[model samples]
Target: MAFLELHNIHKSYFLGKEEFPVLNGIDLDFELGEFVSILGESGGGKSTLMNIIGGLDRNFEGEVRADGQLLDHKKEKQLDDYRRGTIGYIYQSYNLISHLNIVDNVLVSLNMTNLNNREKKDRAIELLKQVGLGDQLKKHPNQLSGGQKQRVAIARALASNPRVIIADEPTGALDSKNTAEVLEILEKIAAEGKLVITVTHSQDVANYGTRIVRLADGKIEDDTRLKPAYKTTVEQPNVKPKVLSAGASYKNAFQHLSYNFWRNSLIMLGTAIGLFAVLLFSGIGNGVNAFIQDQINSMINPNSITVMKNPAGKKMSTAKFEQSMSQFANDPSKLLLTDKEVNHLQNLKHVDKVEPGYQLSTYTLSYNSKNANGSGFQTWTKAYASDTVKTGHAPKANQIVLDKAQAATLTSTKKYKQLLGKKVKLTLPWIDKNNHPVQVTAELTVVGFTNGGQTGAITGTNYSTMRHLLSNAKADTQANFVSVNVNNSKNVKSVAKKITSIKDNGKYTFGAITVGDMLDTVNQYVSIASIVLAAIAGISLVVSALMIIVTMYMSVSERTKEIGILRALGERKKDIRRLFTAESVLIGLFSAALALVLAYAASLGLNHVLYSIVKFNMVQITPGNIIFTVVAAIAISFIAALLPARKASRLNPIDALSAD
Candidate 1:
């Protein structure tokens, strides 16, 4: 039994429906320690036979039996293993990966073994030294001479220590002197108990081998035994190729990406800008919402709901009812809350207390001939008691608390404090039931001044004081509006909803408004604006994804031969896909990092510029936002690379190797 047996091999090529036979009825036997040369013309099928024997072209009808086991060419994994562990190929073109150095080129084949990184490196270095290019180990293929490049190719082929060595036109491009040097190396390789098969057109090259088989028109014409075969001193070890792991794939990906750093960086910059815009806008929205919430909290009590007439009914339109309420001083009966309604509100669920308040449409105050016009007056509620009192105390019965602006208007700024305890005459205007103008006057002492920057020209007094004045003037004492206080701030919304559902005789409904409701409305608007802005920013990410797709496709096209080299070196299709996918993920990671840094810097600059106006940081980047940005970047990039990576993984090894 021979080491390798090719039994009646038949192969052909097809152009549309036309078939061109390349190898017809070829039978050959090979053994270890034999240097066999297949001499032929250009179209005599020597290269085709070499390709089949090397496990590169499996589209043929043949029984390739290695050590008595019939090779199943239909199984891709078996073919890959044969190429990785059983055969080594040397091409005339010196098909070396341009980005890798000479030593690294040899290591590309050694990487298929189970050797450690250091061992692989040492093996690659030793192989390069064996080929007489030890000093040029770090030089790229383009930096070497033609002979040197061929030497590197030979070193790479021998790195795996395969049993079969297939050389196609090994010295085709070299001078006589370099050809002799290469021939000597091939003779030595055969002497080491390995099968050396050289395919060539030169008779001088065929004479170097121990046996020569000449082919003419795809048929063997002559077979000659020139010399006895050399036997090895030691037995050859059986070694299998190791599967490429994810870590190894990523390492190769990083090397490729680093070699094209500037191009990848530009793509990353484009993606980072999009991510930065989205993150920055989202942060701004958060900050704006917080600012509005802070302002609302300072202005109103969170646990209080303001109640008003619903002004909506089947007979009357809401607009018409609102108009009537605005003219309440003319027709006080339109929407005034009666005592019965006030008591009903006070007994509702979650109700702590109901404060009845009256607003007289118009009033005037005379303090020592200093006349001050007032819009309306309200009785102090628990909500109002929380206000900051700049001078004196809250208003009691027969006393009034004036706003700071109104107080400043009635006296000099320095004398405003002096007016706190002074007596003032207040006159209330009204239309009598019989359509007559009337006025009610009362003497009240100034009790306090409120920090009323939020509300203007409003006077606060006790409920009993307003009720007494109204009764003295024979006027309606119905409360204009009531404030419903909830037991807990969290219950404000539920309680407010219940209050709004309260109806008087099924004819009139009430309206409920809580500070939380107002804050929610403000936040809702801010959220909408933020979503719109972020969505607009998100368009850039789509464009960035497209850019990545284009870039990956270009990379696949550029590295077509590299893909072939890796496939020939026993890398799996999944390993090829992982290489490209890993590169894309690295790009995404870099983009996310750059975007986060840029967003942080932008937030700093924006906050620094807006701090004086808003008195707060206007941009807030949360941990969730940062994480979301990073994940989004990676997902987008991975999706973008899917098609390109698949294309690379599915490339034909033969076609890729033939590509320029």
Candidate 2:
């Protein structure tokens, strides 16, 4: 039994079903320590036979046995493994990857070995130095002469330490001196107990080997032994090969991206612009919502919910309850809450206290014969934040807190503080106990100023003080609204729900409104606006994805020959597909990183400008936004790369190796 055997190999090409046979029935036996040359003219079967031995051409009628193990051509994976572990190929063109340096080109094969990265690199350098291109390891293929290129190819082939080395016209493009050096290298390789096969048409080249087989028109014309085979010597252990892992594919993809970064950066910039827009708008929406909540929370107690009489007699949302406020204005009697409802609210769970108060729509403040019209005048309760009183104490008995504007209306804007200690006549029309309108008047001392929130300028007095004045005027002073203060801010919503659930005869009696409900209504509108703007910005991402798709297709077209070389190097279809997809995803990853930086920078600039007017940051990017940007970039790139990568993966190794 021989080290390798070929039995009756036959191969053909078809011109639209018209058969053109390339190889006839062939039988051969090869062993270690032999430099066998297959010499033939152009259009003969020398290269075709080499392809069969190298496992690149499997659609043939034959069986190949490597050390008596039948090579199964029917199993694609088996053939890939056979080529990866058992065979090394040297081509006349020295098909090195253009983007990779000489050492990197060799490492492409070493990456599949079980050796560690440091070990693989050390061996690659060792192999390059052995081939006498030690100083040229950093050089690309274009920097080298024809012979140097061939030497790099030889180093790459030997990197994986395959058992048999197949050279297809290895020295066809070299001068006589380079050819002699290459042949000597081959002779040394054979002496180390490895089978070396060279396909050549040169008679002199054939004569340098241990044995010569001449082929004329696909049939062996003669078999001649020039000299006895070299003595087989003890060889070092070969590197154990493994299937290409996903990590190596991504690493290679990263190298290629780095090699062409300037071009890829343009695509990344385009993608980053879109991501930045989305990130910025989302941040702005977040900040806007936060600012609104902050401002509202500063003026009103979030732990207190304002309960109003349910004029419509049903459970209502904050918005719906707000819509019914105008009807209460038409008939103020209906707005008054009964004593029973106010007492019920105080008994609810989480309720700290329930303060019942009256809200007067029309009123007049008279001081020093200066009169100003006022509205939204209500009795002070726990619902108003103490901070809302910008200056002075809360209104005491016979005292009223006038908002700055109303105080300014009665006096000069600069001297409104002077009116704080002065007495003012407050008069308003109110409903009697019989639902008939009557006039109410009081002399209340102005004690403080406020910056009213939600409702403009509010004038407030104590509940007992207002009740006393109304009773003196023979007018109804029933509480129109009640503030249900919760024990904890977190329980505000639950208390509001409980209040809204309080019913009479299957009809909700009171409508409740909390600070959170108002903030939510404002936030809902802000979110819709931001989302619409972000969607408009997303148009650019679609364009960016299209650019990536076009660029990947161009890469597949440009790297078609490289794809073929990788396939010939024993890479599987999925690995080849992964190469392109991985590169695209890296592009996306970098683009997202760029977008984060962009969004942050833009936020800083815009916030600086907005802070001057609003006294707060207007854009705030969150962790969720960062994650979304990164994920979006990767998903778009992966989707964009699918078709191009698939096309690259499906090319025939033999046909691809021949591509110009």
Candidate 3:
């Protein structure tokens, strides 16, 4: 039994089942301390035997025994372990990863070992120094000369401390002087008591090794020993290999991403633009809804439900209730509530008090030869928030609180407060009990002013003052609607429902309206608009994902040789998959971060510009939105990279290494 034994190896290639035999009954033996050269011609099957011993070619008619233990090439994991622990390959091409420096390239093999980061770096540096290229540790492969590149590859193969160093034409590309330097390095490696197997076409190169086996037409013609095996001298520490961890995969992925960042940045920018649009539209919708609620709640009491005589004597939906406002405008007399109807609502459960109010469709206020016509005149009740009156108190007898616009008409906006104590003539067209139209007028004092920051800004007066004026004009004095104040705010909804349940002779008599109902209607519309705009903006994200897919496929094509290097270095298929997926995910995260920055900048700028007009910030991005954006970005990129990553992991190492 030898240190490594090959027994009767037979191999063939087939072109559509036409078998072409390459290796014919090849039997070989080797030891740990000898530098053996397999000297052969182009088609002499030397490379095929090397692939079998290196655990790269599994489909063959052969049994490879390493120190009397049979090498099971059929089991992929065992083959991977064999390659990681026993075999180190130095290719003719030098096969250095273009992106990594000399030290990092060597560390690629050392990464699979159970060494800490500091120990790995020290060992890689030592290996580079041993090859006489320590000063070029930070230089990439393309920047190095042919000799330097082969030295880096040799250093990398030696990093994992494998027992058998296999050099497949290691000095094939170098000149005489550099070739002598490389052969010296290989002899030194054999002197350290490791098996140095070199495959070569040059007779002079074979003569430099300890033994040369001449092969002609896939059969060994002669085996010659030029020198004795070097005695084992230096002992090495046991380097236990481990599977590639996710963190290492991500680090590799990030390095590749950074190297090609200028190309990937366009994808990130497109994705960020889409994500920013979604964030912006959603933020604006939230801001608009909040602004409307603030404006409405500031002027009206949320706990009070406005009670109106249902024209159809049945409960109406909010949409129907809105449509009925025109009906109220058409016949104010028919919509008027009588004393008995008002009392019926006042006595209901949870009813604090029902304040009978008149809502005039249109009214005119004149003062000192200036007039301002407005609409939605009503008698003020507890349903109105006290803060609505900015200048003075609520209306007293023969007094009215004008909308700020109406007061500003009679005087300058700066001097409008001066008119609070001034007398004004209030007039509106009304209907008599006989259904005849009449002009109702009264000279009143302006006690306060209101500015609701929305449309339908109307003048307000007390019930008694409006009744007195209507009576003086011989017009109808009945209240059209009443504000039903609930004792507790929480019960407002239930009480409003109870009011609708009230009936007269099998017909519903009243309909109730709360500030919540109106606000809910407004919020619903805003939410729909937000979703629609965000969905439209999301189209660009699809394009970005497609871009990522195309980019990953292109990466797979470009890094085919790198994939072969990693596979040969004992990285698992799953590791290759995760490497590509991790890169795409990083792209997603970077895009999300960019999107957030853009959204915030745009929102801040717009809010600043429009703050004076709306008196509020119109865009608000929440923390939840930020989190959702990041998660969405990651998911999209990960999913987009799946097929490409799978394709990359499934590539054949032999084919990939042969790719240009």
Candidate 4:
């Protein structure tokens, strides 16, 4: 059987609905070691016939049998294998990838092979030597001469040691000297027992072939045999090239993008800065919220629920108030929360402890031969009478614990120790039923000092002496409010609900907020800021994607001849598409890496500024965000490349060569 056979092949095209027949009833055959050349004028359908034979175009009607196996149009992988392993192609325009060196360009054909990198490199160098490009193995395509580039293309075609070498005007772009060099290489390839089929318009190239096929209007018009026979054979080596995984392939693509850093720098930088801005804003907002919550925690026990009077005024009028005494200022019968109410609250589920508290503000006291003003002070005379001294030694009738700021101010006056044990005479501004200043004197012992309170600015006073002084001189009100501490924080809300029910008439309402609630509010606020930031970052991401689209489209246009050359070499449309898409995905991944670096730097700067304002560190970086940024960038890249990839895959080898 003939090594290759085509029986009455027919092909056509659709031109605005009218069928244009390009090839009709064409028959051809070739044998091993035969150097054959096909020659025709432009638009005569010579390139189309080559494309069909090479399996790049399968839509045509044809019966192409190779080595006695009828080529099946339905099985794509079978055709792919045939293209990758059984056929090699040389082109008029060199089709080496600009991003790869000569050796890598050749080795790319063996990417799907099973050989390791060393073996693939060795085989690639051997092929390059055979094509007279041995000295240029380390050079890129753009660094080589036109003839040298064509030689590299020839070496790449022979990298896989295919059974056939298909040449489409392989010397079309070279000078006479380089053409002779390339023609000699083709003649040598055929002499190794392989089928050398070339399509050219030059009679000089045809003169080098052992047999010549002439075509006119897609028909074989003449066949001629030249002088000496060509003999050739290619030894299939035991070693082959190995294929890289998807991840590794993209990594290589990223490396290529990095190598061209200056070209894509602005896009990467812009995207990185945008992402950083978003993260920084979110972090600042979080830090502020955390600081506020901390202030609240230090002043009140997280497990304690404050029971205060819900004033008849606006709901928030008493919301942020200091402990007040009006909630208990009622006749025993009118009060929903009397001593009986306190006993009842102590019995509630999860109730660990309770303290009845009452207070009077803006009182003045004299002590230690010095007078200290208690403006804005809270006096708890009726609440926790003996328990206060039980917790800590009772504040002496002559002693007191000054809030740190208050003590500091008093000490700054150089009268602190003198005032600690001195008699601090009390003077209440409110008059009693007797319409005289309600006054009392107590010797206060300075026990300890406290600086922080609910607003992160309050001073503390021991409850005992303050309460004793209040009881000795009747205050405006008694202990009308209570503070309850629960053992289990989870039960605080439930217990508060039950207590509120007991005072159902709203005469004595109780309200409580948990630390967990504050934490949730802070987190929700931060999350909202994060989403807004992501949206802003998205704008930069979109710009990056557009950059990728523009770059890929330009690449496709500029590499049309390269894609055509690949198609002539038995590379399917899928291969062309994947190559373009791979390049785009690589660009996106590189940008994402750049974005991460910038984000980290920005976080450092942001933390410095935020800590100054809120006095706390707040940027929280998670692995999930890193992964999301990368995935989002890559997905955007892939989507952007779709149109360009499709354009490359749809190119016609004939049209492509004609453009040259």
Candidate 5:
């Protein structure tokens, strides 16, 4: 039994069912401490035999044995292990990764071992020093001369410390002096009790080895032996190559990404723009909804529901009802709430009070010969008692409240405050059941000033005083709308729903409106608008994802030979996939971080401008939106890279190494 054996190997190639024999039946044996050269011509099958022996080509008829155990080339994992732990290859082209420095090129092989990072670095440095290029360890491949690049290739092959070394035209591209230097190194390697097999066409190169086997037309023509000039000295290490880890894959990904920083940054910027638009729009929607709710709360009591007569059996949407309300604004009779309905609403759950209110479409107010005409008036209810009054008290019986603007018109600016105690006469108009125009008059004291309404000229009067004046003047006194108060603001929604469910004679349903209901409608519209804007923004993300896919595929094409180098160095397909995926995730993370910063800055500027007018922050970016943006970015990038990464991982090492 020998250290390595090839028993009666037979191999051939086929061109569409036509057999073209490459290697004829040949038997060979190899052992430690032997420098063997398979010298041959261009089509003599020397390289093909070396490929089979090096575990790179498995499609052949052969019985390969290492230390008497058969090498099964059909098992991919076994072939991978054999290539990683048993053989090292040196190519004529140097085949160095251009992006990595000299030290990193060697480390790319050494990383497959279980050695720690410091140990790997030290080993790489020591190997580079052995090839007499220690000072150039930090330089990239393009910075090196032809001889120096070959030296780096030799150093990289030796870094993994395999048992057998295979050199295919290793010195083919070098001058005589450099060729002699490379041969000397190979002789020394064989002297250290390791198998050194060199495949070459030069007889001068073959003479350096202890044995020469000449091949002519795929058959062995001669086998000759010579006296060796060197002896064994160094001992081989008992280390085995370990699987690459996820952390190492990511580290390699970061290195590759950093090498092309500007290109990757542009992709990140495109993705960040989309994420920023989505986040900013979502924040603005949230803020706008909040602002509307605040305004509603300030203007009307949250615990109050406005009740109106529903003329139809079916309910209408808020938008449709609002349109109808505007169209029927002049016909107050269509929206009148009967006295029986008010009594029914007062009997409902959570109902603390029901105040029937009259809305006089047109009215006039007179005080001390200063009269304001075409003024609107409403009966003051408990729900409007607090915020509507700026001074004095809410209107009761013969008392009335006027807004500050209206009071200012009836008196001098200095006397407007004093007008709170003055007596004012109100004239109201309505049509009776007989369709006749009627005017109602009442004299009342100015009790308070209203904070808001249709206009400051509008006045608030007691429901009782308006009803009494209408009765004396033979005018209809049916309430236009009623206010139903609940015990708690939180129950407003449920209470309003109950009020709408209330029906008269099983035909006429009542419509109930609370601050929450109106706010919900407003928020629904805002949410739809936000989603539309965000979707429009998402188109950029889709485009960015396509950019990432194109970039990854380009990277794969650019690094095809590097991929072969890694695959020959024992990296698994999954490791290759993970490497590319990690780079994409890093791009996504960078985009998300940039988008978050931009969104925050935009929010600050927008809120500053909006606050000057509405006194409110109108762009609120929440934590949930930030988190969603980041997650969405990462997911999109990862999905986009899947196909390219898989294509990269599936590349054949032989085909990739052979690519120009």
Candidate 6:
């Protein structure tokens, strides 16, 4: 039985919607140890017949059998095994991997082979020596001469030790002398009892073969055995291609990972920066939101609510009827709230405490050495009717409490402390002559200071002390402010809304804000920041995506002829795609991991700096950030690699082999 057979094969292509037949029914058979040459003009279907025989093109309707075994179309793995184990292909351009050394280039075909590193290295060296490239094993493809690179290509083809060697214009790129040398090698390969097939236009190459098969218009016009059957005495031991173990390809990938570090490094750099931008922006937004909330909480009194009075600016009295219409009268303050009225509001649901706060702008204080004469320190005083005190116990009737900073400034000199027990002179310079500079001497002790030392200060003495100082004179201290404390801090707003109904009845007109409301405002600001940060992050991702696209495109171009060689060697369509995608995924994963590490380091630096300055502890880096970065990187890489990977998978062996 013949070693290889092609029976009644027909092939066609579609030019748009129209059918374009390239090959008519063709038949051929070859035995082991035969040197066969197929010669024809371009587009005469010689290469197409070779493609069908090599199992690179499956579009043809045909029966291709080898060694008496019927080649089943459904058995794709079997076909792959047949191609890997039984066939060797050499291209015209000597498609050696540019990035790999000669030895590593030869081992490229063994990516699917089961051979270990040492054994594969040995086999690769043996093939290289046989092809006269033993001394060039450490050299890159670019370092080799054209003939030398072709010899390296021959070695790569034979690394898997297939039974048949298929050459498509293998000597096309070499000089006449090198062409003769390559043809001599081919003759020797046939002499080793292996079937050798050469597809070429050169009669010189065909002359070295034992048989010449001429193809014309997709048909074999002549199949002639050479007159003398050109022979070579050189013999090589029969070697079989290695079969890879389960998951060996993936394992080998790790072994070869760092071999292309430059490409991987660039890809990793792009991805790392993209992830860094995303995480840094998002984290900053969160930190800022938390900071804002803390600042608001520290600044405002938790129980305070603002009560604004309606304005009646001008007086208009046209007639007695207008005077009778007291609805528009500027007498809202005439019905001043009594202590009973203030206590009535204290009885409302969710009200844990309440206090009536009075603010007077004209009161002033003076010390022996220093004097702060601005409108009563620009602060407020509340009657401490509730049990809540920010600092020490609520002030007694004759005592006062200054904000922490104010107290500290006032007590800076020894004479200022003397004013605490002595008659401290005070004046309401803006008020009428009835309120004079009263020397109200009293036993005044400094109660605890209000307003936490960190936040801004507005709290001052209580109304009990203020009214007591003015007991000899009558003045209206019932001006309008009510502080309400809710049972639960979160329910402040709900109770404030329920109290809004009292405004229509002229009992009160006030607005309330909860800590949640303040927090919500802060969150809105942070959301805007997050959007800005996200936009910046998107820019980095865009840059990363562009980089990946360019890198993969360059890879496709650089490996164009190599892909053609692989296709000719019987790599499946899926295998080609898997190889490129595997490369992309690895690049993405490496970049993401690097980015996470960088982010963690950045967070540490940022936290340390912030703590040193504001004493505020911030910056949180979580494991989720790492996971998110990795997933985002992989997604971007896959997206960027789609077109190039598909292009690589769809490459036509003939066109790619013809490309530079």
Local distance difference test scores for all models: 0.84, 0.90, 0.89, 0.67, 0.84, 0.67
Q: List the residue pairs that clash in candidate 3.
A: none
Kindly provide the TM-score of model 6 when superposed on the true structure, using C-alpha atoms: 0.66
Worst lDDT 10-window in candidate 6: 313-322
In model 5, the clashing pairs are none
Off by over 4 Å in 4: 17-20, 72-79, 227-234, 238-252, 293-300, 303-336, 348-351, 359-448, 460-481, 487-510, 522-539, 558-589, 605-615, 618-660
Encode model 5's per-residue lDDT on 1-660: one tens digit a residue: 368999888899999999999998878888878899999999999988988898878888979987777999888788788877788888899988887899988888888887888989998999899998989978999999878888998888888888788998999999988999999988888887778999999999999999999988878899898865345667666456877788888888888899899989999999899999999999998898888777666656778888877766456765565566665466667777677777888788888989998877778778778877755577877656366576778888888888777787788666788887788888778867665677788788898876553223547788898888788888787887898899988888888778777665676467777777788888999999989988998999899999999999998998898888787777778888998999998899999999999999999999999889878999999999999999999999899999999999999888888888
Q: Write the per-residue lDDT of candidate 4 for residues 1-660, one digit (tens) a residue.
A: 379899999999898999988898999988888899898898888888888777767787879888989998567656666777777877776766677788877766765567766877788898888777777777888899999998898888877777788888898899999999988988888888778899999898898989999988988989998955565346656633233345434544555566577876766666566555554455555555566566555544567776644443223322243223345333321222356656667888897787665434455555435455664454332222232221134244445555544554555545544444433345544333343446554445555444453343332344555556656677433344577777876887777666655554544354443455555665677678767776876787777677778888887887777676555545667767777788787666766787777777777777788778656666655576677777877788789989999999888765765554
How do all models score by TM-score? 0.80, 0.94, 0.89, 0.78, 0.82, 0.66
Native-referenced Cα lDDT, model 1: 0.84
Candidate 2 lDDT for residue 312: 87
TM-score of predicted structure 4: 0.78
Please count the clashing residue pairs in each candidate, in the order shown. Answer: 0, 0, 0, 27, 0, 0
- Residue lDDT tens for model 3, 1-660: 368999988899999979999888889999888999999998898888888888888889988999788988788888888888888989999999998888989988998899999998999999999999979988989999999999999999999999899999888999999999999999999999899999999999999999999888777889999998888769886677887788889988988888888999999998899889988998999899989999888899888899888878767786687677677676777688999999988677888888998988888888888988887889999898869887788998989998887788888788888897889988899989997999998889989998865745858899999999889888988889999999999999999888888889998888778999889998999999999999998998899899999999999999999998898888888999999999999999999999999999999999999897998999989998899889989999999999999999999877888888
Error of 2 at 302 (Å): 1.8
Where model 2 places Cα greater than 4 Å from the true spot, the runs are 324-329, 360-375, 405-418, 423-430, 433-443, 452-459, 469-475
| Candidate 1 Cα errors over 4 Å, as ranges | 67-69, 191-193, 223-240, 303-516
**lDDT for predicted candidate 6 compared with the true structure:** 0.67
Q: Candidate 1, TM-score vs. the true structure? A: 0.80
RMSD of 5: 4.5
Error in Å for residue 96 of model 2: 0.5
How far in Å is the alpha carbon of 535 misplaced in model 3?
2.8
Which scores greater on TM-score, model 4 or model 6? 4
